[model samples]
Each structure stands twice: as structure tokens, then as C-alpha cells.
Target: MAPQDEPATTDEGFVPLFDGSTLAGWHAAPRTFGSVWPGGPDLAGRADLAQADADARAYPARWEVVDGAIEGFQDPDHPGFGGYLVSDRTFGDFELRLEMRPDWPADTGVMLRRRRDTWHGLQVLVDHRKSGSIGGFFGNGLANFHAVPYVLDVSTGADGTPDGLVLEDPATTLEPMTPDKPARLVRRGDPEAFLAAWRFGDWNRLRVRCVGAKPRATTWVNDVLVAEIDLATLEAPNYDADAVAAFLGRSGHLALEVHDNDPRFGEARWARGARCRWRALEIKELSPGD
Candidate 1:
């Protein structure tokens, strides 16, 4: 039932990352608004995502330890481009599990191997819009912005109406594993079944397992292994060519994100009305294939 990489510290199926008590093994590193890491772009700030902010003395701009959980809030007063609620360290070949409830019109994700100033390999998007978004890249390389493990034939676009169709495309055909044309299912389609695939305004379970050197990964939504990606090209030795020229480049950093520019999502989005915090988080053990 766990996303198998390394077994949880306990054996009750999966160990608790958030023991529902306190921040035991977690660290605090706030990525406050306006405080963009010394990275190149001004893609900085999480102010738009949050309504009010905590005391600047107690929490950093990017994160907080509230009610025994790690949470993010962008300054509603400064609704600019939001940045990542980054993890303090980098991880390799690990398993991760977390739950989040997104606000309406959000473009957010969990980024892995996120170098503060460079690129990352794995990114799983908790997209409210019914876009088949999965393992993509950001920063250094434009790896697979829409490279999904599976491309569904769902009706896409502002004018696309459901036409009752389903199809899959090899990752190579489309650049982002995203569809080439507007994808949609017909109106006579099973509403309950389609909705069941995703939950709106509710806490959804997300799990990821990364292994192997180049680090391929498997993603599970509510225990179903819905996607997989081969990270062979991750070893391309092209990230920060100058940085690599100094040393044998081999690894990357990891972090989480909240995307800006609230695009008009389609009806496929279940949580079209949700707003507020995404809670109950944990990251322990690396489940390889369970």
C-alpha cells in the first residue's frame, strides 16, 4: 500500500511522516516573498497564494510551522509571481508521500532535486485543471514541461466540448507528454467515473518513488501507479555547463512549488472553487516499488 522505495520507519503498512503531533524530523527554511534565491530570474515570491502572513520573526516568507503542519502562504498584498516552498536539502532515490488541498485557479507542484540556482529532474503537478501533467522540469533545462506519463484524450481548450474519446501517446510524440489537439470525453461520458479519477476541494493522496542512478520514478494517486518516467537523459551532463566543467556534475536539488498566472481551467478541474491551505505533509523512506 506504500509507494515503496525505503520502508517507513515503522511497519504499520506506511510510517507517518506527520505523526499528527508535531514537527519532529522536519526543518524550517522560509523562502519569503521578494527573497528570491540568488537565482537569475525574478520568478520569485509566494505572496499571492496566501491571504495573511505570519510574524516575519517566527517564520520565513516562504513557509511556516502552524498547527503542527508545514504550510505555505503568499502575501495577498503582493500578488506577484510566487516561488517554491523549497526543501532545505536535496534527495536522491527516495519515496515521498503527501496530501494537499489546493485553492481555486492554482498551478502548483512538488519539485525534486531542486538546486536553489539550477534545475531539477522530477516534478509532479497537483494540477486542478485536468491536464495530464506529470514529471516535468524547470530552471536549468526545459526537459519535459508537459511530458506526461500518459496523455489522455480529454476535451482541452476554452472551446473544446467533450466528444467521448480516449487515447494515449508515446512520450516521444508530444514534447510534454501533453496532447497535440484538444482532448475531451463526450458528454454522455460517465460523470462519476471521470470525477472519481480526481477530487475537488478535498485532500488528495500523492506518492512518488524514485530510484536508479539517472532516477526513473513511479507516481501513485491514491495507491494506483498511474505513471512512470525514464530519467536516462537526466545524466546528459549539460546542466550548467560551466558549473559542470569545474566538477563532475552528477546531481540536483528538490523542492515544492505554487505556480503563478491562474490560467482559465476547464470543467475537468474538480476543485474549481477550492481556496485555502494544502495540509498534512510527510517525506520519509524511499519506497522503490510497493
Candidate 2:
């Protein structure tokens, strides 16, 4: 079924993340990675979490509550600035649900099990740009494994503004899989169904359930199942599930990202002055019985 503008009925045991007025339980952690693509941060060594806690206070994003929703954008003074509005509390196994509406040419995502120090975790890609994909997974620091069903570009009208979205074959736009570096993982979903369920130029509901140390993440777009990844049983090259589990542990904070616009790409990663709006953010913690 297609998602409606009205918020989903709150399920039992679910709790609110955003207070709808202020960012009380959140902090900003700016990522200083040279580039956010291919691989986000080095995972060869563990970062000092204590030091990261101290450093996060210094950097902040232009995130604020507007009309009962959290709006995030890049700083106009420092266009190159990019970071996440991170939750102070960490989660282990949980089911997360939210609604997002991003402007054209925006590159933002929901970070899962993210480290406090850097961009290391599983990312649900909301790359609303050329050659980007929605409802997919990106391994931020785990060998850059991309598990998307299809790539997408903006469809433009005569005036050169975005009119709709155009779906493309991933094979044509993304790097081919190889033995040494198999970057792309198999995604579970029908592309046509995803397109039909997606609501262009409007708010879309996203649901994600992640569990275990080496997690099994399942995603839904407007209630259509789009992606499911079992990290422990994954067989992609250079993706070590055990190592990833060890590094990240069983719990981490949830984050909303505002990516930097790199000069090498020629075009901005995030559109100038464009902001992504989020609302109805909530999560339900899962126990062993669940």
C-alpha cells in the first residue's frame, strides 16, 4: 500500500526520538573524512570513544525544529561542513520508523549502529541525486559494500527543475563486482514495486528493523519490503562480519547525516540551501523473545 501523509498509528512499546520541539537527547558529531564515498572511515583500528565524546561538542550542524519536524542542512558559512545529529543514547536491537522528505539533489541517510567517533556503521541510503538509490544499504567503513536494488536520477522538465525520478539499472552506473573487491551486495526487493510505492516530491515513510551483533537489517519503503541483509551470513569479498561485529559491538547510536559536497565530483553532494525534513521518528527496542 502507498504511504499517506498522516503519521502511522503508534505501536505499543514504541518511544519517540524527537520531542517535536527541541533536540534534547541529541548531539552533533561532524565527520572529517576526506571523502564520504567508496569508504567513509578507516576501520582497521578502533577509535577512542572517550575522546570522540569530548570532540563532538565542538562541531554542530544547522539542525532545528520547524513546523513540528527536524530540518537538517549544510552550513552556509561552511558549505563543506558535514556531520550527523546523533542520539545521546545507544541502541542494540530495535525497530525504527520515520518519515522523510528530502529536496532534489540532496544526499542524506539514516545511520544505524554508528560509532561516536566517526562514520562507521550500516547506512540506509537516501541519496536523492543522480545515480543514487533509495531503500538500500551502504557499509560506511566495512569495505564500502553497496546493496541497492537500482540506481536513480532526477527527471527534469523544460525549465531544468526536477519533475520526477528515473530508475536506472545498477550494472550500468555502479562498479562491476570483482573477486578482489566485491563492493556490491545482492539486495532483496522488486524495483518496479519500489518505484510504485515511492512517493516522489513528498514525504515517504521508512521502516527498518535491525538485530544481532552481526546484524540482519530489513527495510521497507511505504510498507513495501525493499531490502533485507543478513550481515553474519553475507559472502561478499573484503566484508568481514566478525570484524565488524567486534568493532561496533552490539549497540550504537542512531544518526541523521548531512553529507559534504566534495569538489572532485564537480557537482554538490548536497544541494545548496536545501534541507531534509524528518518527522514521526520513533523506535522500539527488541529483546531476545522478539
Candidate 3:
């Protein structure tokens, strides 16, 4: 059976995705808003992030309550491209439906199976300009250009795992789709098809569903289906592939992100059990299948 909080697939049916005006089931991570709050393990002073001096604000990554919603914006200068506003808890095997409208020229997506600011599942591309952008993050494993979009190339070493049983070369592991590739089934290997489909300058509606670790993601631009992907077993060398697989077999979080160097706007709303909006939020709980 699916977990109680799994998205869309409810045992009893009709679980609130968000409250009208608050982040109820979610918790803010340490460096949520700006950097961290002034007296916590999270960023309090200034998050030493790349382009920290850009649109980046004070610590805790200042999230504001605007027009009755919890909103986050991209810093025009930061280049991390994976800045996260993660949920403290981990989740799996559920459906998530949310409304998102990007107000900038940045790439966007959310994560599942994230731990301590690390992501282990997939990143459904909001912008269509990445290789395998429709594929999973494949952390320490594989990546589509959109997975880590600062550059079209990936860089890694064999030292990815503590035991070194696996070889991780971000350059090779993370494949990038370039502008030369076209969008045909045969062209899927060329990489450009991944980016050619990317659309910019618009509001996107996203729906993500995870059945254990196998995930299905789809994106819509102004209500038009722009992207879709279905993933089988998500492989990684950083964790015991089997154990990592099991951990994601139950529950996790609906962690949101604002990748570093991004210029987009993001907010999440649900009518679940809570009645609050998320600013710099964090949520923690044992991932499902624990």
C-alpha cells in the first residue's frame, strides 16, 4: 500500500496537497530563506554560496509572504544551479501535484529522496534546455545537462564512493544534450533533442509521482504538456544501491529548489493539514520504507 502522505494516490482518497495559506507538513531547512538564521547550524550570516553577492540576500535565504503565498526568487549571480529549499523529511511512492509559475529565465524542478541537502532521485526539468533534462538526477551517477546546468559538461572522479567500488566521472556519468541534436527517437542519443524541447519565459504546471524509487514526471506550460519521463530503477554509487533503493520504497519529502544562479520565482501551495505558508522551510522525518 502507498504511504499515508503519498501524493494523489490516497488510500482513503482526497489528501490535501497544501493548506490555503501555510506550509503545514513541511519544515524549513537550516539555510532556507537567505543564508542561515543568526544562531543556528544553518546559514545565519551569509551563505558562502557562489555569487553570494548577487541577488542573494541576507542569511536564511529570505523567503517572503507575498500575496498570501510563500515565495522564493533566484539570485541572478549565483551559479550553483541547485540551491535547494528542501523538506526536512524524506518520502517515496506518492504523487505530487502543484502549481508553479516561473517569472525568470531559469531552470526549475523539485526533488524526492533528498537527505541533508543532497538529492538522490530525479529533477524534472522546468526549462527544456538540458540533456536528459527529462531524466533523473543520477547523483554521483548520471546527469542530463539540465540536472546540473551551469555548463554542458560534467566533471567527476573515481573517488565518488567511500569504498571506491564504483567509478564516477561527472563528465561521462552526466551526459549532456547539446543544441545540435534534434528531437527524434533516434536523436535521443544525440543530446540536443533534450534541449531543443526546453521552453523559456512562461508559467509551468508540474506533476510528479513516485512509486517507490521509480518516478514519473510531467510538465505543462500554460496547461500544455511540454515534457514527460518515466524512470526505472534509479542507480547510484554513493549509497548501497540496495539499501538506497529500500529507503526510497516508502515516504520522503516534497523538497523544493531554486538552483543557484537561477532567475526564476517559486512557491508551493497545498490544502493538506496545515494552514501556513513556507518561507525558508525544512521538514524532517524518517523516509518511508525505513
Candidate 4:
């Protein structure tokens, strides 16, 4: 049964994903963004994820409603781990719009097409720090940006241990599709426009469009096109072309995320004590023509 404030599974046209009073249709994400990858814990080694899942369920304490907005406040004492408020239902082709404000050094973003088991999906970056670029596409569990524009070829020594490698090496074993012009992970049409459009220290509007079987996602920040991503071309280690294609076709949950605290990436210096807020969150489903 649906809660009183929960949105219905089927709505007429556009619908508010959040009810503003409670997290009726949302749950805490099973894991924190960017914590279990790269230099973090091994996902398979974590035997206590269930407890973390339970902690995620008790999200009211971590994420609360304040003045009609959902504010994510991080505990200064518990700095390293982060959490996500994820939608229970999954979505496919649609347009999602929301307004966000990052205080000081808060690192955050919106997640779409996120898989439950793999925890991999397309993340629309909302980083507001001077070194960060908002509206880039983050391929969860991938190399943090667009996949390599070309494939690599390895050369095997006499011992056959594969000693050398090169981009598009003629002796490559796997089939490589090196496009004449490979797609970029994030495409900001006009950097100047993006810079001018940003409303620093205030609410900034963001819109993301995901459509088609190949899922080309384009993001707009304050009415400026910040990025255009071909979801299929997004890459991470061990994710081959087939894996990427399958992920592109499947529907997955939508989420909002906070980057885990890490001193190496300057999170400890900047992200600690930071908070991010979201409001006016909504989504509109799309049809073939529309």
C-alpha cells in the first residue's frame, strides 16, 4: 500500500517525485557514492552492508525537511561515509528537473538509471567547488569520465605475459570500434555561458533529458547546456561494450547523492561540514515523438 504522501505509480503527465513533507517514496541508498571504488573498500569484502542498508533506512536523521526543502546535513564527527536518498521505483526515458544549492564545499549530484546490484549508472555532477565542474556525466564505477575514445592493443613477450600495449595496436585480439570522432563524456556547449549562468551561493536550476535506446543525456544548468553525454560511450574498468549496452537498455532507480569524504580529493579540506539542498524536484515521462 502506498503512503498518504507517496506518489502514485501512474500519473496523468508530470508528477512531483518528492512530496516535500516526507520521504514517502524514497529510501536511503545501499552505499555511498564513490566510496567503494577506485581506492575504497572492495564491494565483495563488505560483510556489513546490511547494517549500512538499515542505517540508510533511518534517513530522517541524516536528511531532513527544512523550510520545504530536503537538506542533507553531514555529521562532522562521521565525516568519511556519505549517503543517498534514492527513489524506490525505477525510470527509463524521461526528463528530470530540480533546483539545488551547495553550501561552501558540498559535493553532490543526481543519479539516474542506477542499477541496484551493480550500483552503476549515470550521475549528473553538481559539484560547486572552484575545482569542480557541474553537469558532467559520472559513469558510476567507471573511470570518472567519458570512456577512452579508442581501444588498446597489447604485445606479448616470448613468455606470453603481454608485455606492451598501445592504442589501436594492429595485433589487438578484441574487436575495437574506434570511431573517427569518439564521443566525449561531458559536452559543455559554451563554457562562458555556463559560467555566466551559474548562480553561486544561491539556488540553481538544473534539467536532465534521457531518451532513446542509446540514451543520449543532455544537461542544462540555469538554462545553459552544460553537458551532452552518449550514455553508451561512458566507460569504466572491466565494463566492455556489451556490458555498457545492456546497462543502457535497463531501467533503474533515480537518486540524489553526496560524495564520500576523502582527504586525497580535498573532501576533508572542503566538503566537511558542508550541506546541499534540493527543492521543486519533478519528472516528466516521454513518449516516442514527444
Candidate 5:
């Protein structure tokens, strides 16, 4: 692995996505779009295209380069508005590596093979909030299938400030399995190993590898294998591999999300003034031979 401040060498076959000083190759996704639920409204249809484009141009989230890192937060002026910073290039099979440190209460993620026109894809969960789970798989538009290893809660210090995180049993934390909410295909990784590898309040390295049209995606947190999902064959309720492949295709842009602070939650989904910082973003496009 290369240092966080420098790009990987050619020998490593990884090219830098972030230039370390600017958002040169990135653009914002649409703002005001609702979370990509199973039966969510079609915000990208021709009927709404004009409005969606305008929202994208306005880009409600604040994304900027700070101290050699990409900092993303909900724009103060546009409270409750959040969006994604998407890469200009699209990739089919690739391994993405980046370092991220998100503040508590933020529901962020790395959207893989995300549609250029909307927030539809496979999401690697970075939900840094109450009862949230990291390194899980969330189907943004593929029937909302969630495959999480485990959920977690934050530990507070004496001053009532978040001090650390405590892993919780998925059996207790997750909602009961149902037709709309399925977890039977979840690949629950080692919780103790993940906890040991996780660095609280510090930047943690995340690596994701996606391959094939009906992709097999895997995630690692701080070098600890967190979760894996073979989308093509996983027997999860409401998931259709052929339909998903048709919807997303073999290639799409990668995106970094800054989630909305929904009013329904009452409490802010993202902490006020808090930003998630990302650095050392690089990707290695995979070939069939390799």
C-alpha cells in the first residue's frame, strides 16, 4: 500500500482518483433526491430531469479539498440536503482504495457502479450513526436488500461525547427478516477481528473490489475482511440479479455520499458542521487475465 499523501506507483497498477489538492475529476450528483428505497419515486425520469439537473448544478452538499483530503458535509445554507461526489470516469471491474474518517451521526457510503443519472447502485455502508453498521452491502435501487455483518452503537465518555464504538449482535440490532427486509444471505464476518482492526477517531483504510457484470463485491476495513457478497447468486428476497445487472450494467461511476438529514428521523442524520474526510483515493482497473 502506498502512503496516504502520495499516489501509488505504476508498478502497483493503481491510479489516483483524487489529485490531493483539488476535486478535478469529480462532480456532484443531484440534490433533493430521496433515499434510494425499493419503491422510491423516479427522480430521474424525463418528467423530473429538468429539476434534477438543476439540483445537481446547485449541489446541496459542501465538497472541497482540505489539507490534501476531500472533505464532505451538508451545506449549512441547504440544511437537510445531501448528495454524492461522483467520479467522471466509469469502471467495470476494479479495486478501489481510500482512507476515510467520518464523524458520528453521519450516514455516508461508497457507492459502487452508481448510475450517472441517479443514486442507484450497490452501496458499501459507512453509516456512522446509532445502530449503524460499516462494511455492509445496501442495495440502493435493487430492492433495498441489506447484507450487514453487524450493527453498532457509539460509546460516550463522561462528558456525554462519543468516545468509541461498540459492536452489537445483528440478531438483536437488525429488524426481523421479512419480504421487504431480508438478511438471510448476509455474510457476517468476524466481529471481534473487525473491532480489533478498527481505529476509533482516526482514519481507517477501506478497500473494495468489484468484478463481473453481476458483480462479486468485497470490502475490507483497515485490512480486516469485513464482508463479501456475490450479487449474481445470493438468495436474498426481493433481489433479482438479471434485473440488477440490466439496471446498473457492467460499468458505472464511483461516488462518495453525504447523506441527507431527514426530518422524519427528528434528530439530524448528519451532525451539524461535521465533515467526513477522505484521502488516498486510488483505483486499479482489473482485467480478466489479472
Candidate 6:
């Protein structure tokens, strides 16, 4: 069924992307990596957005609308079929704001500047597992950017490992890390202040800004600047820096990822992995001329 047509704009210059009632202007994509990327099976069978939206709406076990929020679930009876809900419209430079809360052990993220055929793009991770690496960049098939505290404590160290079991206090130093590139300790912002401001057990405000020309991306959690990365300068082995930089300039859709869990981990694990909720998604377009 086609979603009801509604005004997707507001007076505040923030466009309503989700409409809080329907999945209009959005297409459901299967898990971008294992099922849709390089050498992967094509799980995104149909090409139409309405069909994809219908499929997602029908299977509330995977994606559903609840009280104005987009929710993803991993029911024991329905597992492993995970993917992303991608916006049909493409955006260039923009400021996006949203609130998200993941269930315990669930993993999810907001992906931006994504290419159409594959999931090669940047993402802000909402990892709620014991990993304790929330609000980091997932990189998808591209690159991962993370900010870690510089201070000594139990939950973190200079090497990005848990030095102790207890976090006595917030660390003052926030550093950038690219574990996939084996890179670490790149200074970014005030980690301690970000931690002190982060509110657990509730919806966390996330804001992302992109330049798209030179391709500088910045992320904030609960209004605290946690990471800023220049895609043009990112050093990733086996990846073309020029191509990566060019890819960032391409306008693409905003996708909400429904993390795919390994089936080998069993249904219980899958159920835990697919739980997340998002709300208040709004975006303001910024032109180069502006």
C-alpha cells in the first residue's frame, strides 16, 4: 500500500523526513554488506520504493512504526533478515538531527552519503553492546572513525582497551581512532566532557554535519562534538584516497541501518542484535552558495 501523502516541510527550515505516520519517500534495503555489497547476494529484490516499504511494513517483526518512531526488532521467530531503511531523496550538504535508543546488546547506525548499488559510505554507530563503543563511525565498506577518551581508566586506555572493570571518572581526552587501519590516538575533542554530558538509559540526541565538497564530516552526541573527519585525508590501506574523496562528494540518501547478526550466533543472539528505535529525524539542506 502507498503511504499517505503528507506535507514533509515545516516553518523551522527543518524538513520532516519520516512524516511520523508513514514510510513515504523511503525504500527498505536488505542488510547492505553480507547481502547486497561486493560478491554478495542481491536481497533487495524489487526496484520500487513502495514495494520495499510494504515489505517492511508487513513484516513488523523486522521494521515497524511505533508512536512516531521507526523501530527495528529481531524476533526469535524472524531473524537474520536485516537491512536498511533508505530515504528515496538524495541530499548533498546538510545538517541532520535525530534521537535514537538501542535495546541492550543491539547494534544500529545512521548512514549518510550512501551510493545506490552498494553500502559504501559513512555511518555513526549506535552500538549498545558491552563493546562500549557508542557514537563511533562504522565506515561500512569504506572506513571507521572513532573517538576515545585519553585519560586512564578501567573501561578505556591509550590503546583503546579496557584497562580496568570500573570507570572511576570520565576521561578528559578524546582521541580519534581508525582500528581497521590500525590507527589510534589521533586527538579529536574533549572525551571526558563528552562522557560527562552523555545521558545513558534514554534517547540520545545525535547531530551530523557534512560539507560534501572537500567532504568534512562532523558528529555530535547529545550536543557534544565527538568526532570530525576529513574523508579526503583518511588513510586506509588498499583503498584509493582520491576515489574515496570523490565518493564523499556524491549526494546520497540517509539510511537507518538494521544491523545484521550472524546466523551462527543463534536466534537468541539475533534477537538481541536487531533491536533499536529512532525518532525526531529532521534535516536542513545546505547549499554551497549558502
Which candidate number has the best lDDT? 5
Kindly list the per-residue Cα lDDT of model 1 for residues 1-290, writing each as its tens digit: 22354424645344555545444433433333322222223333355534322333233324455565555544454442345555444565567777765544345567665555433334665554344342222222322223343333333446764423133345422224434111210111232343355455456677776665545656666665555544543223223333322221234455555443333332233233223344555555454443
lDDT values, one for every candidate:
0.44, 0.75, 0.37, 0.64, 0.78, 0.61
Cα displacement (angstroms), candidate 1, residue 199, comes to: 2.3
Candidate 6, residues 14-65: lDDT per residue as tens digits?
8768778777778776653323323333445545434544444444346788
The TM-score ranking, best first, is 5, 2, 4, 6, 1, 3
State which candidate, 1 or 2, has the greater lDDT: 2
What TM-score would each prediction reach against the true structure?
Answer: 0.56, 0.82, 0.48, 0.72, 0.85, 0.72
Q: Write the per-residue lDDT of candidate 3 for residues 105-222, one digit (tens) a residue.
A: 3344566655544344455444322222332232211232132222232222587422211212346523344432222111122224333433333223344444535444444323
- Measured with C-alpha atoms, the lDDT of residue 64 in candidate 1 is 52
Q: Mind giving the per-residue lDDT tens digits that candidate 4 earns over 1-290?
A: 25555444435456788777877778775443333333444544466555454443343225777887888765456554566778888888898888898775666778887766445677877655433447766667643444222333334579875343233443532333433213565564565566567666688999999876557788888888767777566454543545555644556778887666453565632366778999988898887446
TM-score, predicted candidate 6 vs. hidden true structure: 0.72
Task: Kindly report which residue pairs in candidate 2 clash with one another.
Answer: none
The number of the candidate with the highest TM-score is 5
Which candidate, 4 or 5, has the higher TM-score? Answer: 5
RMSD (Å) per prediction? 9.6, 6.6, 13.6, 12.4, 4.7, 8.0
Q: Residue 160: error of model 6 in Å?
A: 25
Cα lDDT of model 2 by residue, 1-290, tens digit = 11223333465778788878888778877754422323334423336443433333344457889998999887776564567889888999999999999988788899899888777889998888777777888878766677776677767799997888777545555333233222244356776788787888899999999998888888898998878887887766477778888878899999998776655432346777878889989999899447
Least accurate 10 contiguous residues by lDDT in model 5: 176-185
lDDT of 5 by residue, 96-175 (tens): 99999999878899999988877688899998876677898888877767887777777789999888778744565534
